[model samples]
Target: MENVEESLELHDKYQFEVKFTYPLDKTVPYTEYNVETFMFIPNNLCVNHTTYTKDDFYSDMQKYIRLKTPTMLLKNILNDDKSPLKALKEAMKTLVSEPNNELKMLDYKYHLKMFCSIFKSALRDETIFAEKLNDKEDAEDYIKSIIDSTEDIVKKFRDLKDIIHVPGLENKCYALYLFADEFVSLSLDKYRYRMIFNLDKAEVKNKKKIRSELIDLLSAEIEYRKSARYNSCPDEKSDNEELIYRESTLKKLMGSVLFLKTQTMREGIYIEQIVMGLAAGLAMAFATAVAFLSQSKLENFTFSLFMIFVIAYIFKDRMKELTRIFFHRKIQKRLYDRKTNIYNSLNQKIGFCKERFAFFKEKDIPELIKKIRNKDYITELDNGYIGEDIIYSKRFIKILSKKCKNLLDDFNVDGINDIIRFNIRNFLGKMDNPTRPLFMPIEGDIKKIKGGRVYHLNMIIKYGMINKQDIYRKFRIILSRNGIKRIKEIPLTI
Candidate 1:
């Protein structure tokens, strides 16, 4: 009883002496207190008190103690009765050496199923989107749904893999995981989204513009027709007539738009077809070559090899040329039709006058020029109008002079002319008779030519051998009369 009384007295005395320093007439700074002092403060006195109950504190204390204890020591203590730790260690070692093959097989099966399901889902989405593209909003919603579905499937696979454990299963899981990431990455690619968005925007803008222009034009025409009718002979006509006319005009315009769209689609299809055909042709050629090589005897190996290589080369070259010609022809046809359409439209709007005087005449020259006269600038040249006299006339000379002047202003023509002269001399030097000029004389020293340099027409004549003196003489006379006298001199030799 005395000892208990002594302890209580000691505790009271200690509590009385423990005085927290509160700044007088100023707020006490919480940070000044030591951790122990701060912790000792009562709930009411503490600045930011957390009300942790006794049970909560005890649980947290237990957890801290558990974490502080060494793992090995804890294991030993736990297995003191039956040595479960040793057994578990041995089991783990065995598991490492000889993993559960059955589990691995099951994982593989699950993985394959998931892969197939993903592919099926993707195909389904593509089909649905392709079939139901009547509305743009619906199409976008469908795409988003597809992406979401894909992401969900990937997550499912990930979750499935997480619960399973087997040797090499992780590797397979990792591969599948990477594949999922790739699929997601492709779907999320900003560039792909931008491309699709841009295409859709362009299509929308073009459609809007076309519709606006058509409506305005139609309205103007209707107003004009109404005015003309009222002025000429006022009569109450059936409203159906105007409606029918408008409908017909709209239909015609829509038909033209449809035609353009069809042409574009057809061109794309043709390109794809040509590419597939070329690929197939190449595959066939390779297969044939391999079969021929396999069947050939060792004695004729060199000859067969040579023949195969030569044939392959020839085939490849021919195919390249054919493709080039095909594309060139398509481009040419499109350009020709476009030009023709433009000309026809212009002619319709502005009545066709005499061919020579038509302002909107389809000439090779840029349409920027306001007026074109027959003797304007000593040139009346047209790409479509070809004749010997036109080719050799002052008009042609003036056109060439103007073009040459532009070229000279834009580039170092003197340097280019030098390069041309050097190449020509080098080419001529290779011949047997180097001193004797192989073609007609170029009218003057090419190096000394002023703004423009002249190339002899005969040098281009077949094999640099044919020299038509009459042509050269005529050319010279034309040039001299046109005040273009500085021509490169070359001997005429056939």
Candidate 2:
């Protein structure tokens, strides 16, 4: 009786049939049967649903997946009582309401995961998204919106500061202000995220532990800004005048202005001997002219007069030599007075400052300064005498100050050191070796020389050297005390 009941049930199950129809109109049919009935008849089951493919299932699944993912939704929303799955279903319906490629792809969970990963990565390393974000002019407006929002938070914090005694809030507030300041200062070429990151590192990281240090740095920067040291638009009035004067002055002083005395005086002594010889010739010529005129022969008188005239011409050249000597003395005196005035002025300034000029190496001019005093132009009793004067006189100082005050104002001890080095090289070049080139290698090239290869050459010529032309180039007499000491330390040489 149990076998009979099973057979009846099997027959009822085998009575139903199933079929599948593809989009191409091909159809497959099958009869449903129990395991026992399948022995008697060929049994096949065709399983088919709506026309949706695997891709369609994935597309539908993505919308629900994104809505369910923890990172995609806000923390507060994800924590609510509603089931994430149920919420996702509703979200998917809303999301797919619009038809687009993004909407079409939203159904796939992998697609959603990929999208979320890309978004997160972009937020983490904003350089990846910078181009996309900054492609529009409205990017600035978007950034301003974020800044405005942050400002509101700052305002709220400030408002609560009186009521709530937050110990570390002040530092935090300062850090925020620094961040805002840096953000506003950023250029369009710079990535906003980098600026923010730098600001956080520079300001926020040390704000709590090294509050005073951070504040001090900020304070100094603020003070510098207030002083207009880095002003983008400098005071145009000062700049314009400085520019005009620099152009005009440099143009005026373009070429060498020869002071004749130095050249003429050196050549004068030789010319004087020539003048005396010419004077003797003139006396001889006068005697001849008188002798010839007494003869009263017209041709001889004319010839003698011409000869006298030639001798007179030679004498006239000697007058030019004498005139030059007189003028050279006068010019030398004037130049000495000018140099003395400048030295006295500089000495006074240096004395008041109690800082000795590095080049001079003297507190005051010594009483036994015989070399300078021996000059015909300078008197031993002259109170204006400071010492052997520098080539940089009052006019040079004034002109340099006016033209390069901007540079000097920015100068430091290192710049002064460079100036000293430059002046030393210049002074050395001028002293008894003006034509012999000074060959100091550039700093980069200096390192290429082996240690043992380098050597020093120091020579002192007391009376200067005589050249092949028998011309005696005068010894440069204007050495500072330091210069004299430096020269004396070395043995004398030609």
Stretches off by above 4 angstroms in model 1 are: 1-132, 164-176, 187-195, 202-494
Best-fitting candidate, scored by TM-score: 2
* Worst lDDT 10-window in candidate 1: 1-10
Clashing pairs in 2: 59-107, 62-107, 62-108
Q: Write the per-residue lDDT of candidate 1 for residues 1-494, one digit (tens) a residue.
A: 00000000011211111111111111211111010100111112111113333223222211000000011221222234422223323333443354556554443433343333233334344534434465655544544444444445434433443433445444654454343333323222322344344334542324444334434533443464455332211135644664445434433322221111101011234654676577557656765675566456444557767676677666766765676566655553332111011111112211101100001122432322112111222122311222111110000000112222222131112111000000112112212221232333366633332343221211111100012111221111112112222323233332
What lDDT does each candidate get? 0.29, 0.27
Candidate 1, pairs of clashing residues:
441-490, 442-488, 442-489, 442-490, 443-488, 444-487, 444-489
By summed lDDT, the worst window of 10 consecutive residues in model 2 runs over 36-45
Q: Output the lDDT of residue 312, model 1.
A: 69
Best-performing candidate as measured by lDDT? 1
Off by over 4 Å in 2: 1-300, 334-367, 370-425, 428-494
For 1-494, candidate 2 gives per-residue lDDT tens digits of 00101101011111211111101101212111111010000011011122323233222211000001122221222233432223333433443443333543333222222222222222334333322363334433333433333334224323432321224233433332232222222211133344344434442332243334334434544454345332321244565564345333422221111000110012135545665566556556655665566456555546766776676666656665565566555543333111111112112211000001111122332322222223333322231343333211111111111221222121110111000001222223223321233444696564333221111112111110112111111122223212322211321122
TM-score result, candidate 1: 0.19
